[model samples]
Target: MNELVLTLGWLGIYAPMALGAASSAIGCAIAGQASIGAMTETEGGYGRFIGVSAFPSTMVIYGIVIMFTLNRDVTPENAGGLFGIGILSGIALMYCGIWQGRACAAAINATKEKPEIFGLSLAPAAIIEGFGVFAFVFALVISAGIS
Candidate 1:
């Protein structure tokens, strides 16, 4: 029993951050591809702008994890803490990007046919961004050592 516990503990101590990072990276990549698909399928020529706009947010997320790792005494047992923080931030950025892309697409369509409906079409996107911001705030709080 003691040996099993020890083995489990050791595994726990070294697995969370690594697994979380890989999983989150995969999710972020998928989200990125989805966003690109949205832009390319809609705007046809705004791929560069969409790519550039999304880059900063993604980099910021990666930087947050790197900085946290560099500055903290992270271990597998506490890897959940880091993973939670990263997840929060990544979700926020991804949500915002997806929402904004949708809004932009809607606006483009509206302008081509009914300009006055632009404001209505934008409401959902803006609301989605708010949810992302809320997630970011909560994640920041947790990552800042509130746990």
Candidate 2:
């Protein structure tokens, strides 16, 4: 059982990064597709579309930081803490990334239609990013208390 627990602890350490990266990849792809479509329709300001598409990529960076924090000794005493923090944070980040991507896509599409509302259109995506930040910050705080 010790060996199994240790293995799980290691798994927990890496899960955040894996899940986060996958989430970010999907999110970025979704937004990128919208940006590509918008680019074809717009005459200028292609840079804003490209910039908005990258909004979801920050989730992966949060995951990487969580992974590093959790990569310490995987003893049975703290394995459960590692598992809980890693898995929960990973799920939060994953969902946030995906939804944020959708939000960014919507923003891009809306802005392409009415360039005047470009900044306003990004409100939803920005709110989604805020949630991701909350998860990331909470994970860091929780991880510190694990040991």
| Tens-digit per-residue lDDT, 1-44, candidate 2 | 99888887888899889989988999999999999999999998
lDDT of each: 0.47, 0.91
Root-mean-square deviation of candidate 1: 6.8
Deviation of model 1 at 72, angstroms: 2.8
Enumerate residue pairs that collide in model 2.
Answer: none
**Worst window of 10 by summed lDDT in candidate 1:** 51-60
lDDT (0-100) at residue 45 of candidate 1?
37
**What is the clash count of model 2?**
0
For residues 33-66, what per-residue lDDT tens digits would candidate 1 score against the true structure? Answer: 5455555445343543344224223333443443
Query: Which stretches of model 1 miss by more than 4 angstroms?
Result: 1-71
- Using TM-score as the measure, the top candidate is 2
TM-score for each prediction?
Answer: 0.48, 0.97
